[model samples]
Target: MEATQILDVARDGILTMVIIAAPVLLAGLTVGLIISLFQTLTQIQEMTLVFVPKIIIVYMAVLILLPFMIQQLVELTERLMDLAISLP
Candidate 1:
């Protein structure tokens, strides 16, 4: 494959990955922010307070967004396959 085609594929793969990961990452970020704010307000500085909630939220987000993630990945794969088939 030419460099441009290779770059395009790489870009597509990266964009797809980012799209798939955004929901989980955003969920974790939102939970962490809220926990931090609560701790600041209440003065309860428990370092481990963030982990469980963040993990649970992220896990739930993943579970909920799983289908969308899979669809994005499948689309990326199909595009790559099409490109390969058309290449040679």
Candidate 2:
């Protein structure tokens, strides 16, 4: 493939990665922020307190979003394979 074609593939790969990661990342971020705020207000300062909830919430988020994530990944893979087949 030409350099431009390679670059396009790379760009698409990055975008797919972002799209796939966005939900979990955003959920974790929001949960972390809320937990941080609670800690700041209550001044609990217990390390596991933050870790456990964040882990649970993230896991739950993953479970809830799993199907959608899988769909996007499958679609992206299909598109990528189509591109590969078309290349030669």
Candidate 3:
């Protein structure tokens, strides 16, 4: 592949990765922020408070977003395969 084509592929791969990861990461980030706020407001400084909820929420987010994530991956794979087939 030409350098430009290779760069395009790399960029697409990265963007796809970010798209797939964004939801779960955002979910965890949001939960952590909200829980942190709650902890600060209520003064209930439980060590496990931040972790457990984030884990559960992130997991739930992944479950909910699985189809979309898989579809993105499949699209990426299709693009990669098409590129490969077009290559000399």
Candidate 4:
């Protein structure tokens, strides 16, 4: 493959990875931020308080988003296979 084709494939792969990861990451981030705010307001500084809620929320988000994530990954794999098959 040409350099541009290679770069394009790499870029797409990275973007797909980001897209797949974004929901879970964002859910964790948002849960953590909210938990931090609650802790600040309540003056509670328990380390497990932050971790458990974030983990649960992220896991729930992953479960809810699993189908979409799988679809995106499958599409990406198909596109990659097509490119590989067409490559010189």
Highest-scoring model, lDDT: 3
Q: List, residue by residue over 10-40, the lDDT tens digit for candidate 1.
A: 8998899889888799999999999999999
lDDT (10s digit) by residue, model 4, range 11-50:
9999999999988998899999998999999999888898
Q: Which stretches of candidate 2 lie over 4 Å from their true place?
A: none
Task: Give the Å error, residue 50, model 1.
Answer: 0.8
Write out the backbone clash pairs for model 2.
none
Instruction: Put down candidate 3 lDDT per residue, 2-74, tens digits, no spaces.
Output: 9999899999999999999998999999999999999999999898989989989999999999999999999
Give the higher-TM-score candidate: 2 or 4: 4
Q: Count clashing residue pairs per candidate.
A: 0, 0, 0, 0
C-alpha lDDT of residue 59 in model 1? 90
Error of 4 at 33 (Å): 0.5
C-alpha lDDT (0 to 100) for residue 9 of candidate 4: 89
RMSD of 4: 0.9
* Candidate 3 runs further than 4 Å off: none
Model 2 Cα lDDT, one tens digit per residue, 13-83: 89888987898889889988998899899998987777887899889989998999888889878988998
Model 2: what TM-score? 0.91
lDDT of 3 at 50: 94
lDDT of 4: 0.92
Q: TM-score each candidate.
A: 0.97, 0.91, 0.96, 0.94
Better of 3 and 4 by TM-score: 3
Each model's C-alpha lDDT?
Answer: 0.92, 0.87, 0.94, 0.92
